[model samples]
Target: MAADDERGRGVLTAADRAYLRGDSEYGSVQAERNARARIRDRIYDALRDFELLVEGLDDRDLDLVFEKRVGEDDGTEAFDALVSTLAFLYRGVGRTDLDFETVLREGVNLAEASEDRGATVDFDVTYHALDADHLLSKLDDDESLSLTEIAYLYESADVTPDELAAYFEDARAPDIEDGRVQSNVTDY
Candidate 1:
């Protein structure tokens, strides 16, 4: 089966984009902030709950699972995003608290609940801050992360807001076009 087309990937609403761009002159800044906060909280909660679903199965090839699931006709990009985000957190952070029994039991319960709610979890923002590359880019460029990004980092990587400022302090700075040769020239 062919893979599902990507939908809602890295897509944000107009209001959200505007707010992130700091366009809050006459609008209710508080209201926009609150709205964005609520959405981010929901996504964070969803990621945590889904994390419970895959708490165990060590040594298993999750990449194969992801590949197979994505090839299914019923699969959606959302599933891909969820699995990718989960894998990133599990692998990148080296979290070893795995319990297959709990995952099996709770996974079913979570699926059932989500089905009843007609897809309660939103996976569109999975690429926001969950991905390592995106998060690193944000840190590398010294850009401010959105609330969703902050929540994902905290939940997935245990990164706190206070630590964000220094997350990349030790990394080499991005190259600049000052047009200079090596500082230490070797004379033969």
Candidate 2:
């Protein structure tokens, strides 16, 4: 929709559909498949916009759930949409057998895709707990940290909320102002 270029069959607005041909005429962009994708993109964008602005007038509508926490007042509400989204994305992106939490938080590395048939890719992702000491130790001052230690750190850690908040206790930190970053991180 941005006025950036005059190429690529332009936008396929619904109003312009009347001029569309019944016979499959390939576009210069590529072939019939490429043209079909472009047209589909146009239709989906229009419908998505319409739903977002016009279809949510009723707050109690069950079909319009967008967040995983909805209907959880009693704590047993299902997270179907969340589960489906994660499953579909992992499958499409060549990942299977991965848990939703892992995909949501750490994500997968796709570069090693050809390593194994079971895992579309091969990856040596290291999970770790991180603290300021761990990160500062990755630096190269004579106080320069050991590369092995840094590797070991990332291979197994996450920074606890309290530890990260303590960063600003030093008065000379980037996320200063009484550890505001720590406060926001805690909120998350």
Compare the candidates by lDDT and give the number of the best one.
1
- Model 2 is weakest, by summed lDDT over 10 consecutive residues, at 179-188
Report, for every candidate in turn, its global Cα lDDT versus the true structure.
0.47, 0.42
TM-score of model number 2: 0.19
Q: Which stretches of candidate 1 lie over 4 Å from their true place?
A: 1-26, 55-65, 68-188
Residues 1-188, candidate 2, lDDT per residue (tens digit)? 33222323435643234326342354565666676777778756754664454444444444354333355422212433344445555564454566544544433333122233233334454666655565655432324323333333333346443443343234233433332332222211
Q: Tell how far residue 88 is off in model 2, in angstroms.
A: 24
Task: Report how far off residue 164 is in candidate 1 (Å).
Answer: 28
- Listed per candidate, the RMSD to the true structure in angstroms reads 16.3, 22.0
What is candidate 1's CA lDDT for residue 77? 46
Query: Could you estimate the TM-score for every candidate?
Result: 0.25, 0.19
